[model samples]
Target: MKLENYNVIGVMSGTSLDGVDLAHIQFRIKDKKWDFTILESETIPYDLTWVQTLKTAVDFSQIELEKLNQEYTSLLASIISDFITRHKIENLDAICSHGHTILHQPHNGFTLQIGNLPEIADLVQQTVVCDFRVQDVQLGGQGAPLVPIGDRILFPEYDYCMNLGGFSNVSFEENGTRIAFDISPVNTVLNFYANQFGFDYDDKGQISASGEINEALFNELNNLDFYQQNYPKSLGFEFVKETVLPIIESFEIDITDKMRTFTEHVALQIAQALPNKNGRLLITGGGAYNDFLIERIQFHLPSIQIIIPDNKILEFKEAIIFALLGVLKLRGEINVLSSVTGAETDHSSGNIYQPK
Candidate 1:
């Protein structure tokens, strides 16, 4: 299938604080069918200072956050330019960036993504599409779990699409309606603890497997009110620090024990989201690399078939979806799902910036 000029760079910085994923992809829609080829992909890890700033920015005042937003935009422009130059990319269509989500307290009717500066378009010399979640939030939506629209469009074969990145979010088609919700914390909380041991992440779930589960903490996490609140719900770092951290800190458990119990919690929550016992599930994001976590989830739901594709897909699934969202926006199609986000209506979302 062939379509008119369909190439893009998809940029994503997830809440996990892992890194920026840049995927140069070629997408074609012919006769209402969509296909894509990943021409190049790379992940650039955040510097220690940037990581620290992002982690602590939640506590900053409004002025501080404003400055940080500008600084973050500058950093994004620089990194994106480097990526484009390194790949010698040309014949470009647009750069679709899911900017680093800084503040996501959508119940207050606002959401902020920090790296959508017009300077990025000037620096990269390309059309840019970003700031995807605010409109939905304004319309009384969760302003998250936005990938479900792409899941429905691009990977319709899988009965469920689960992404385990900063957060665990699952999406699937149920009764001809697409539904999704954030299940639990993932790399965000795990990496927070892992950093104490001087490791960016628990490689292949080694640290978690070696740890013992703190039964008290495990039960507390399982019984959290959020878990029982029902679907169309989302989570952010605020939820982590305000709700999760305090609960975990109340117990005098070792770091390894905390990891173990949290891993169990994540697995159980994810397993519970499966709509059908025997349906095929496509799992992506950094959590898919956690063998121990996968073991626990599989143990919990033995009948479901869990499939993990290549490392690129696992890492850049969200980035790819952001690119698809950009395509939908460019075509003036509905990219945000009302069912997934609890919005008043399904609609296209994002702002477009053309290079000056």
Candidate 2:
């Protein structure tokens, strides 16, 4: 096999709306195995206006969304351009972006991730690979949890790779194929309740630790239909805004109580999702910082050891993996898994746009 290497920037804006994450990565395949180094990375937090706009984008009309898409494409171009300039990164291949998802109702045969337009290549003066989820949705798949392929390639030592992001998802090798799916909502639900208490997030799960878990609320959250669904399923902001919040709001419980009950609910759901009880599980994403939340998860499954990587890996793993996805797309290899997304087949899924 011939040797190849790629230097690219991976950009991601997740459902939590925390910010756009950009990472400069160097990837190489040696002896048919992949290796990577995250060179430079920074997260540009969304401004208040952008945050509010994205938060309400689910209700946007078709025409309004079209307009928003054009504007967001420009926004992404600027962000990617500045990151390259600031890092003085001149040797580059392409920018792989998981553009923010505005709508992801795969069960209805639709998903939208804005900020991926052909013009981004020209504006950033680099090739771009993005819109990674649409093709999977078209193939009768959930079109999410795309990072699992990355987990399999980059961090295969762990028995399971779990991301506690806007939603929680896990991926692992089962038999000869990779199996993965979204487990439940995580920071998406926690941060919302945290914001109610005048904080961006529940630091160290402090608010939840102080409050009491409402048993009724806890039971309802645990019993949600999505939790009972099997693999290849996904959860999105729509599920949170539509199904989750309303259920939580129906009760006249204290805000902290809501937070506590939901935290326990998150732990229980995660514990129940795993198939193994005695293996190392690598945990990453923002919610990994929630000490109390981690404690609860450990409380439920003491046999499974959870490993937290270094800060850079914990923070930029998704960005780094998307960089790998772009390399795979460029190489015409499979980046999205059928086993993970329930697609008709495992396929290379992304759009590549070269600078004009």
Candidate 3:
């Protein structure tokens, strides 16, 4: 296949801390428009040890983190190679990865995303584009919710695009300007509590459905200062540890009750971010699988139309968006929105690493 016609693979590791998602996508631009088809997709769950390491990676020392980054890059490369071989993939154009986020404190003038090492390109022997956020952050941006650019470009029919991943974020246009922001923590806190019960997640939110809501704790979360902040803001693991965890821990609520209350907290925060009071909202991400959580959100925001797409879209939307980001970067078009990220300007971002 020609380079323009060749297929690309996009990778995403979300905050839900679920696992790495790989989307083998065929992308092309014809008549000044973009089109894509997901040829294959898969989620590779993290091992218990890797999960623990990534969970605590934010606090690691510089030396230790540098070492970890190299290892993570190697691991990502290995996985991509395995996926390609297993699927008998040929004519690969490139691989774009939104590597696992490690640090996103952009206000302090720094952000880091591991697994962008050149070793990945060498291993996969394909053009690679990764680390799409640092440059935007350095240019005075939030370094987050980058998917809105893809949402606007690829899935523009909906009035709002709400993703209930590890974090809840919504993207919509207002006054003819695109805007998005992180509403609150979602699976990040939910999965944390779920681990206490020896399960990776609360399947269909069974535990939360069985628990009672603690009004006090729910109110505390709702009253968070971040909720009062304006749009173009984002969240990180640090926010959970500092703002959310402390507030939740102060309450003497049972684990199930805490889950139920927090689920409500997430639902309300998400509902509040919807721009149009009565238009359709396209919801995706793993949290969409949480029946109880969705019910809570729907209950709170009855005016909005919540539409969940196919299972593949729910599972691999981030990876799919990352692929679109790569396409934008390759074409030198704007991939990160200044309106969304508070960047100096909207611009294309990502560093391409060609195999040696």
Best by lDDT: 2
Ranking by TM-score: 2, 1, 3
TM-score against truth, every candidate: 0.98, 0.99, 0.97
For each candidate in the order shown, give its overall lDDT on alpha carbons. Answer: 0.90, 0.92, 0.89
Candidate 3 on 37-91: residue-level lDDT in tens?
A: 8889999988889999999998999999999999999888989999999999997
Query: Considering summed lDDT, which 10 consecutive residues are worst modelled in model 2?
Result: 1-10
- Residue pairs in collision within model 3: none
Cα lDDT for residue 257, model 3?
93
Could you tell which candidate, 2 or 3, scores higher by TM-score? 2
Q: lDDT-based ranking, best first?
A: 2, 1, 3
Cα RMSDs, all models: 1.5, 1.0, 1.5
Candidate 2 wrong stretches, greater than 4 Å: 1-3
* Cα-based lDDT at residue 72, candidate 2: 97
lDDT of 1 by residue, 245-348 (tens): 89988989789999999999999988776767778889999999999999999999898899999988888989999998987888888999999999999999
Better structure of 2 and 3 per lDDT = 2
Of the candidates shown, which would achieve the greatest TM-score relative to the real structure?
A: 2
lDDT of 2 by residue, 1-356 (tens): 43388999999998888999999999989877999988999999999899999999999999999999999999999999999998899978889998989999999999999999889899999999999999999999999889999999999899999998899999998897999999899899999988888888999999999989888988888888988887889988989999999999999989999989999998998899988877999999998999999999999999999999999999999999988898999999999999999999999999999998
Question: Predicted candidate 2: what Cα RMSD to the true structure?
Answer: 1.0
| Native-referenced Cα lDDT, model 1 | 0.90
